[model samples]
Target chain A: MAFDYDKYLRPGKLPHIWCPGCGHGIAMKGLIRAIDACGLEKNNTAIVSGIGCASRLPGYVDFNTLHTAHGRAAAFATGVKMAKPEMNVIVVGGDGDGTAIGGNHFIHACRRNIDMTYVIFNNSIYGMTGGQFSPCTPTGAKASTTVYGNPDPTFDISKLAIGAGATFVARTTAFHATQIDKLIAEGIKHKGMAVIEVLDDCPTTYGRRNKFRSVVDMMKRLKDIAVPVAAASKMTAEQLEGKVLTGVLYKEEKPEYTQQYAKVIAKAQGA
Target chain B: MSSPRVEVIERYCKGCSICVEFCPTKVLEMDAFLVKVAKPEACIACMQCELRCPDFAIKVFKD
Candidate 1:
């Protein structure tokens, strides 16, 4: 069947709030395609988002959406999924929202292995809050808050998620549209906690401050810096310097939080 | 070579008119807050309208 994106898009909201040349739209399209590919019922889906440019996504899609306070999407989504185990819960937020202020929740969510998908739109900067420094902002990158350049190293979200016990973890860039769609689709279908970090561009704040000539230049940088895991495995650590790995970094199945909790409750009741 | 055609789903259009003002090619026109493809043929497939639309109401499909 031909893909019909309009069916999932909310009408009367035609123009989005993202700036021109921003990568959020690219990520959103990939997500929509993934949902379509998974054949998920619209009514069965619930998207939760925290404050950020990326968090604004749930408001645009025609689905059960919860726009929560800054850096709290995971906590809110946890409650939602636990309350309705049958609903397909997905969390959408940016680097600052998911990894900075919400860092504690992010790790707990991964460790809990909840049945949900978390899509981190990592544009590096806090795009929605006027381009502040975020936990994922690259070292030496400039932001509104980091006028002289960021001094701290950025968190490798994929590695962090895997180490924290996420059952599925992947990384992709908006430049690689097709691959992103596939990754998001797989994350949604995974029975346990899944995290997909999408490297995106924030042309207005990130690009302008970082000396990126244009949006295309920023995308090119992502493409040039990203390395496939298979290819990286063949290379030495020295050879992998300054390169980020894209594709499925890790996947392992374990009991999900909600199901395990239910079993515990059932056993206690019986006893 | 033909350019991609942009379709605006009016129902989803919040009528912010961001597309109408942002279209570098002047491809969009506003009518009572709703945007119409005034110059569909002129679209360069830059996807500015599609990307910037907060509502995701506009789609640009390559012909």
Candidate 2:
């Protein structure tokens, strides 16, 4: 059968609410392609999102969607999955919503190795909240909240997820549309918790203040800074210092949380 | 091969014109405070306009 993406999109919501030159739209298309590639049944899919520009994704998608509170996408997604184990649950949110206020939940979710895919749209700023400093905001970067420059170090989200026990973790940029779609598709197929961090641009909030001439300039920067993981591994720390690594950073097989919980429940029932 | 085509939903457009300003190929134009696809042939199907519009008013499709 032929694949049609427009079927999944809400007709009236054609124009998304992200600022022009923002990277979220590219990420969204990547996600749609991934979902289509995986052949996931739209009726069985459930998307949960937190408050942010990225969180608005659930509303636009045709599947079962929930727009939860800020920084609680994972928590709400966990509940959705646990309640209906058959549902293919995916959590979507921005860097601040996923790595800042939702940081703790993110770690525990990874550690639990739940059967869910977490897609983080990391634009390095709190776009929805007026360009505040996000946990992933790079050091010395300027934001509306950080007039001088962001003094805090950025969180390497993929690395953090791998370290926290996610079964699969990948990193890609909005510029690498095909790669992003492939990685997201792989994440969805993984048995245990999977995390994909998509490096995106926030032109209005993050770009204007940081001196990005335009959206194209920001995309070019992403293309230049991104280094394939295979190539990066062969380089020295100094060589890789300022470069961003893209591709699957880690993957492993582990018993999923829901499956383990089912065993425990069976034991109790027998007892 | 030809490039991608961009469609702007004028009703949803808040006249941000970011699409016109940010398109790398200069595929979009601002006419009367509204964005119009001036150079659809230059689009790369990047979906940058769709992603960047705060109003969610744009879509990129192949020709």
Candidate 3:
């Protein structure tokens, strides 16, 4: 039997604004499946995002959604989690929105160890904002702003989340369809802050500037460069060079912020 | 009827060709920027096209 995705999708929202070959839709499906797998009720879950191509996702899903300003999804999602600790809060945004503009908020959210899931659609460029080079854009890659090739260094988002004390961090690409949901489901099931960075493609803006002939070419490139975490350990450094690691990269247990805050409130009340 | 049902929701399809290109059994084909069931008998119902579709325009149902 086919998966009944329509159950979670908001009616009359089909035909999303993403381009024909864009991978954001793929990520959206994975998210829907993850939410279903976790058995989350639509009313009890909140999907939050900031401005970007990926941020538009919350509008299409049937959930308590917050489409906040650019670089503020994490901050808003943190607030949502703090106020409604029982609600399953999930944050979705693009690489630029999550890392570049929202870097401060992003790191702080991870540091707090809030019980929420943050899914970063790392397309490596600001697709909605005219192909501008982003912090996750690989050096030497071409973007609208980087006509001569991106000279700026890239921010490995998974590593940043892990460093900021997120309990769970995972990375996967759009080409690996099945793994996306599995990792997301795991992240949602995990106790503290979980960050799942999905390396999707922006064929219209990033691919055209970078000389990718077609969407298939871009997907094939993503397929070629990804190496699973278990396989990466056995491969030589030379063989692993230029390859992105997928699967759960980091995970740890810690005190969650909302729970700690509740304790503080209780102590203040002398209860 | 013998193999499986491959449904293409034309209203939602953007005709990206990702499904036709990824179909392992070559059971699908493009017709004027929309997907059509070209060879229904060849469909193994693997759901690759359905899973990879960026648009929710395709589905494969097997009983």
Give the alpha-carbon lDDT of every model.
Answer: 0.87, 0.86, 0.93
For candidate 3, please provide the TM-score of chain A on its own.
0.99
Interface RMSD after interface superposition, each candidate: 6.9, 5.8, 1.0
Window of ten residues with lowest summed lDDT in model 1 chain A: A1-10
Error of 3 at A86 (Å): 0.5
What is the TM-score of model 2 when looking only at chain B?
Answer: 0.86
For model 3, the superposed segments whose C-alpha errors exceed 4 Å read none
Give, for candidate 3 chain A, the lowest lDDT window spanning 10 residues.
A1-10
- What is the DockQ score of candidate 3, to 2 decimals? 0.76
Report, for candidate 2, the interface RMSD: 5.8
Better of 1 and 3 by lDDT: 3
How does residue A175 of candidate 3 score in lDDT?
95
Q: Which pairs clash (backbone N, Cα, C closer than 3 Å) in model 3? A: none
Each prediction's DockQ against the real complex: 0.14, 0.21, 0.76
lDDT digits (tens) for residues B1-63 of candidate 3:
467888999999988888888998899898998888899889898999999999998888895
Identify the runs in model 1 with alpha carbons over 4 angstroms from their true place: B1-63
lDDT of 1 by residue, B1-63 (tens): 567878887766766555676689999987886788898888888776775564567888877
TM-score of each: 0.84, 0.86, 0.98
